[model samples]
Every structure is written in C-alpha cells, then in structure tokens.
Target: MTREASPAQRTRALIIDAAADLLAASASGEFSTREVCDAAGVTAPTLYHHFGDKDGLLREVAADRFSRYLTRKQALETTGDPVEDFRRGWDMHVEFGVANPALYNIMYGRRIEGRTTPADHAHAVLVTMMRDLERAGRLRMPTGTAADMVASAAVGVTLHLIRTRAAADDHLSALVRDAVTAAVISPPTVPGAASVTPQLARAAAQLEAEMPHGSVGTLRASEATLLREWLTQLSVLGRMAGGAPS
Candidate 1:
C-alpha cells in the first residue's frame, strides 16, 4: 500500500507550499501571518492553529526547505570513482533544483532575504563524501581560511550562473560541480577533490557554529581526519591516472 501523509501532514504541507510561494514573493524580506493567510487561502485562526504564529510558521517553512534539500541529497549515492559519485550527486541537486526552483532559492539563492539555513541540507552529502575520501586517502587537513573562501566563491559563482540563467550555464547542479571542481581540485589534490577537506571543513564549521555547541565537534574531527587522508590518497591516484600533475 502506498503511504500517504496524515491529515495533519497534509495540512502542514499545504501551509508550507503556500509559505514557499509567499517567500518567493517576499523580495523585500517581509513576512507576515496575514500575508501567509492570504497566500494559503486560510483564516488567521487556522494558520495559528497549525503553527503557533508568524514566527512559528516561518520556522516551519524554513524547516521544510531543509527537509526537502536533505531528502534530495540522501537519494544520490553511486559506486565507482569518487569524482563520478560527486557528479551523480550534483545531477540530483540540479534535478531537485529545477523541479523545485523556489525551494532551491530558499536553500541557496535567497538567504539574504530570508532565514533559511542549509546545514541540514548539506549534512548527509558532506558526511558521506568525507568518509569516502578518507578511505581513498586523498584528503587535506585544516581546511582553513582558504578552503572556506574558495567554497563560498565556488557555490556563489555556480548559483549566480544558475539564477541569472546564463547562456553558458550548464544544468544548475552541473554548474555547481564544475565551479566547485575548478576551485577544489589541484595537481596536489585528489580525484573527487571538489568535496575535499576545505569544502567539508566549511560545511562542518558552518553547521557546528549554528548548533548548540558540541553537536558537531565529534563529527567534525572524524570527518576532518577522513578528509585529509582521503585527499592524500586521491592525489596519488590522480597522478597515477594522469589526472593530476606529477
């Protein structure tokens, strides 16, 4: 039997979809319960009933974006070369993005105008890649200031291309991977180095800093070590494959 959302979940999804539309329209970053009601075709009481109030509604809406983004990340795992795996993941990211353009905006495109966070969204993919890279022994360590800046630049460039609908733009997620890859991979880097230590470090630090201290400390250390080792090994393999300069 196909599983369907409970009545409550159905209502929640309806409210979330309405809020997403409103958020897209909120080019001014203004959010309001009244506006939500207008968007949702519901009265104040019903809106309040499902969610305590405006803040509550906004929180749920942001949470929904995280949930949707996470779901997409979780679905994309492939075996073989780590770089190939990353390419697959990027494909899914673009598929989800194009299919849910507004949700994509919430996760990546429109942070300045809203309170959406991508920590939950990037968690699974970052974690998995860190591990795989570690086992492959081609990761670097202390993915510090440089890594952080590079990541921001890469994602920003890719998302900018996507949002601007650049004529040279490939698929949205392909742009993300290529941008990320160009910044990440190096002669001393690994094959799937795009998801290497610096990128993972940035992801970890961002998530940890936002969490209630201690939430991601262990995960960070473990992932960091794995990433360093992974990048190391990948560098060797990449050289062997003639993908990296000797």
Candidate 2:
C-alpha cells in the first residue's frame, strides 16, 4: 500500500472538509475566526498560513462555489420556446436551490449577513435572458421591466421550494413548475410559434460540455434532466397562462 500523507497535507485536507461543512451550515451570520479554528481543530496561525485570513478563506470558497453554480446554469438549453425556457428555468432554480441550500441562501440574502459582493456574472446572465425575452416580444407588459419581475419571482419560487418542503412525493417538481407558471407574465406566441426547434438538443449538448472538469459536469446533467421534467409538468401552467410551455 502507498504511504500515508504527511501531517501538513492532512491538516490541509481537514481544513478544506471542515470549511465545506461550515459553509453548508452557514446562515446569515458571520463565522468568527475563533469559531472556525475551534470547529476545524486547528489554530488561528495555521488558518492564517493556509488561507491568509478568515475573510480571504470565505471569499475563496464563495468564488469557487459560485463559479461552479453558474457554470452549471450556463449549460442549460433554452429548448427553443421562450415560455418553455422560463418553465425550465424555474425548475433549474428550485433544483439549484435545493441542491446547494447554503450557497443559495448566501447568494439570495448575503446582504443580511453583510457579505455584500455583487455577483456580476449572475446578474449579467439574468439581464441577458430578460433582454432576450423582451426582444422576442414575450412580455405582456407595455414596458421591458418584466424581466426584473421574472427574476424576482424565480428567486421567490426557489425560496418557496426550499422553505415549503412538501411531502416527499415524486411530483414536487411538477408542483413548482406549475406554481411558477402561474406567477409569470408569459410571452405572446402567434399560433404555431411555440413549436419545438431543431436547435434545442444541440444547444443543450453544447452546454453540458462546457464544464467538463470537477463534479460540475455530472451535476449539470442531473439539473438539466430535472429541468426538462419540470417543463413537461408545467405545460399545464402554459395552457392556463398566456404563454407557451407553461
């Protein structure tokens, strides 16, 4: 058998795992340096040497996890129908929220914790999607502010899914999709405009390949599948609302 690692390597491994747990357990409060040291069974000097400082370590973890999440989100396909995309997007929101509850809470309400870093990439993606829908003439509103509403509602729906933890039924995704559909003001599609596009599968395939390294790739595959199933269920929402793929 191979020899065991040295003490230094062991310490680093311990810190990383502890940090992950701490991150998962993290709420709207800041974890003091002393608290981290106590939790990790390491000294402050060791943490400082390994990660510079507490804030530095937290930032590092945030950057890493945020990158991973966006990388996964970027891999999602629009499925050719703007309405369907929104439905799928809502599902993605909930799954992402449920899968990474800690990160979701952090990003959603970091201000409460006084961690006020602007997640530029995330805002950019939201803006891009909103603008794209507007260009497609999807918003029923006279103005182009519907995207903001959609983003807010999406986040709300995500929080609802996280907080409401209904019975462990198989159709929870369906429930979320329908609920989200009822919430959004959908696009107007002249008859037959909502048909499936040939570009969808290809686009989805391209998205999956973007995050090949780390567990991000496998995780995204699950997210995509969950999103698709959610879309199918939310079709009821589409019929009830004035949109496609509801």
Per-residue C-alpha lDDT of model 1 across residues 100-159, encoded as one tens digit per residue: 445555556543333435633364346556455545643333334324543454456555
All models: lDDT?
0.56, 0.59
lDDT of 1 at 43: 82
What TM-score should be assigned to candidate 2? 0.53
**Candidate 1 ranges with C-alpha deviation above 4 Å:** 1-7, 22-32, 39-41, 53-55, 77-79, 94-102, 108-116, 142-154, 171-176, 182-246
Q: How does candidate 1 fare on TM-score?
A: 0.54
Candidate 1 yields a Cα-based lDDT of 0.56
Put down candidate 2 lDDT per residue, 1-246, tens digits, no spaces.
989999987886677657756778776435677777787899989988977876566655565677776678769765887777766666666676776666666667553222344344565676777677657755434333655665666566666666775322226566545544433444354454344433443444344345334454444544644544444334423443444421
- Candidate 2: residue 18 lDDT (0-100): 72
Clash statistics: count for each candidate: 14, 2
Clashes of 2: 2
Report how far off residue 123 is in candidate 1 (Å).
Answer: 4.2
TM-score against truth, every candidate: 0.54, 0.53
